[model samples]
Target: MKRDLELLKVILSKVEQQPQGAPFITNKDFSTRDPSLVAAHIQLLCDKHYVIAAQNGDDKWSISRITFDGYDYLDLLRESTLT
Candidate 1:
């Protein structure tokens, strides 16, 4: 599947909002979107070193935290959307 930058941003934002070292955020939390789609985007985020995630299955993910790069990218995304 193609990468979804918007979804990537949303995932980062959600992960950031969670408390430090909190339990992993799963696709279930993103109920509005298809779980596989969310999981795919999450895999991209993990591959990009944006978020730390563990693969639960072929189309499942458990995201734990956002990396420094993740925060930086999220900040840029937020800024770009404002103008």
Candidate 2:
């Protein structure tokens, strides 16, 4: 779960540096070998209101943006890790 959260943080940071609604491709370099687990992580993010995920009919996913709550959560995580 910790690794998943870290991966999500990385993904969010990358998306933040890009334009709004920019398409993000999930690949070997961008995700874990277990995509099903990653999908679960995304679902949790959505439930927590941290991010919004869109899935096309063909099953492609793109993150729209991160909410303020997401940033706050990540910041708290970072502080804990540093301490």
Candidate 3:
């Protein structure tokens, strides 16, 4: 699990598009990814207030949703990517 900012952006975008406060459906809506890794990334995002994640569990396929801060972060990342 390396730091994958691009994938992080992707996750953020996916989650942000969902209804407010509703976690995105990782299994059905997004591309295939390692559940554990996605969870870890979500945790990192949570720490930054970029997303809201559930409690860590043995079930790796947990869901997360983006926040207002997340949209802001995404805009920042997008700018960085462009420049």
Candidate 4:
């Protein structure tokens, strides 16, 4: 599936706002969005090293946090898209 840049930004922002080392739970946080899409986007971000995603202890839900690279990427997007 193609990357959803908008959703990616939302996820990144959420992670950034969260306390350090705290995971942003995907399901709980992205309640209004399509779960599969969110998961796919989070996976894509993780694959690109823009975010860290972790799922443990048999929990079906995964959590993520923005990485330094994610901030850089978000900044680049902001700069490039600004009028």
Candidate 5:
């Protein structure tokens, strides 16, 4: 769970740095046999308010926008990266 959460942070950071209406494929391929883990990581990001998760009528997740709070958090992480 710890590793998954860390990965989620990185993924969200990447998306946040991109344009507003960018398309991010949360699931890359059909071989993603572990849906539970992926969902958990996405939930963690949602709980932390890093990213917005929207489910269309087709049960597919759509990432809308990354909040300003997320950018602020990323900036703090950037400071640590320099050290």
Candidate 6:
């Protein structure tokens, strides 16, 4: 599947909104989008070091927190939306 930048932003925003160290489980969250799609993007995020995630036995990812790079990217995304 193609990369969805908007979904990436949404995922980062959701992860950022969570309390520090809180785990954002892919299967439990993001009901509005396809589970597989979300999982794929989350894997991409983890691969890019944008977020710290752990893979569960069920093949779903749990995001613990956003990295500094993640925050930087998110900020840029938010800024772009303002224009």
Best by TM-score: 1
Candidate 5 displacement at residue 62 in angstroms: 2.7
Give, for candidate 1, the lowest lDDT window spanning 10 residues.
Answer: 74-83
What's the C-alpha lDDT at position 31 in model 1? 90
> What is the per-residue lDDT of model 1 for residues 1-83, given as tens digits with 9 covering 90 to 100?
87777887889989999987688899879999999999888988888899988998888899988999999989888888642
Expressed as tens digits, the lDDT of each residue in 1-83 for candidate 4 is: 77777887777777778886674566457888887777777777778888777744332346566778999987776566531
For 1-83, candidate 2 gives per-residue lDDT tens digits of 45465766665566556676666644223554466555556666778988767664343455677789877876765666642
Task: Give the distance in Å from residue 22's predicted Cα in candidate 1 to where it truly belongs.
Answer: 2.0
Which digits, one per residue and each the tens of the lDDT, describe model 6 over residues 1-83?
A: 99988888999999888886665656459888988788888889989899988888554878888899999989888788642
> In lDDT terms, which candidate is top?
1
lDDT pick, better of 2 and 6: 6
Q: TM per model?
A: 0.89, 0.64, 0.72, 0.76, 0.59, 0.85
Between which residue pairs do clashes occur in model 1? none
lDDT of each: 0.87, 0.61, 0.69, 0.72, 0.58, 0.83
Model 3: per-residue Cα lDDT over 1-83, one tens digit each: 68888878878877767786574555334458776677677777878988766654553434566678888999997888542
Model 3 collision count: 0
Regions more than 4 Å wrong, model 4: 21-23, 55-61
- lDDT-superior candidate, 1 or 4: 1
Residue runs of model 5 more than 4 Å from their true location after superposition: 3-5, 29-36, 55-60, 81-83
lDDT tens digits, residues 1-83, model 5? Answer: 55453555565666676675667645332134354555566566668887777654342455666677777766666666432
What clash pairs does model 6 have? none
5 Cα displacement, candidate 3 (Å): 0.3
lDDT of 5: 0.58
* Candidate order by decreasing lDDT: 1, 6, 4, 3, 2, 5
